[model samples]
Target: MRLAWKRWIFSLLAACTILSLHAEDEADLEQPDDVPWEEVKSTLPAYPEAGEWLPFFVTSATTNTFYIDAKSLEGTKDGVMHYTLKVVSENGAVNVTREGMRCSTREQKLYAIGDDRSKTWREPRNNQWVFFKKWAINRQLNVLYDDFFCPGRIIVYNVNDAIRALRSGVPVSGKSSRD
Candidate 1:
């Protein structure tokens, strides 16, 4: 009789715990979805110097070569990773921009553009966070997010980890290329 009573009590406790968790989940689901998320203020970094550019492979299909500024990589407290990107096309046209990526939402924002002649940064007209597209022509940001900075949908721990991941061509957290 004692063993049976103990078993019954244990089963009851387990069921009660499961129901409580379920109730909490239901409450969470009932909350409004329009709650605004707060983002940390961003201070734009200086334009990347010529020596700070580190080439990263995105895909072989495109003739444009992509590079990230080693000195501009930063992991912010709000989980946003900021960096400067430089793209050189086969035709010799070069484009440079400062950008930020949020691993939590898989979104990217263009902060500023670099003027090669003045070696200065200018704020982009549309400096809004937008979801990454699936098209092949714009795969540079996606590659950076998937391979180096935000593998497994989690941001790197710090700037050093991000630089390490870039240099090694893999994620620092041990997640595989596409995990």
Candidate 2:
């Protein structure tokens, strides 16, 4: 009986150790490959607040710049954070307007550095703007350096994902189909 108990304890300890190591490996895989982790951390801008406008441009195409006015941050509820945003083009034209864009905390942490604030903005594509939201600025840096864009053109990464979700017909909080 004593020996059986000892074997059980040893097995439990070994399993726990293996699980811990696996988690550590998964975390390391999440880091971006193009930029050094430290550089990515140093380059991020401060988190935006209501009424602040942030100018962002894709590095590969410098002239294609846009602005996002931080309209509001409706606090997190049920593990998801809600945001309101206004995306404008360089010529002072409003491209896309979003109300209560939903971002889950899990997605926020994956691409963000520091406190992993959810970052969502619009990017231009095919002569129109598309919504793209990543967790952090570091993710943006990685995308700017590695992703493909047409000459003198800027586009968002996987805009279709947002479109697909929208087409699914799920309504955002505080808004209804009747509205």
By TM-score, who's the top model here?
1
Which stretches in model 1 have alpha-carbon errors above 4 Å? Answer: 1-36, 134-136, 173-179
lDDT of 2 by residue, 1-179 (tens): 99779768876775565456422132432333454332111122334434444444333222244433333223332222233233444575443332222121112222221221344343223322123332122233223212211111212224332222233332222222123
Worst 10 residues of 2 by lDDT: 145-154
Which 10 consecutive residues of model 1 have the lowest summed lDDT? 22-31
TM agreement with the true structure for every prediction: 0.74, 0.26
Output the lDDT of residue 76, model 2. 32
Error of 2 at 167 (Å): 33
- lDDT for each residue of candidate 1 in 1-179, tens digit (9 for 90 to 100): 99779768876775565455422122322213465666788787766665477787776555688888888888876678888899999998989998888877777899999998898988799998887643323778778887778776677857787787778877666664434
The residue-level lDDT of candidate 2 at 119 comes to 44
Alpha-carbon lDDT of model 2: 0.31
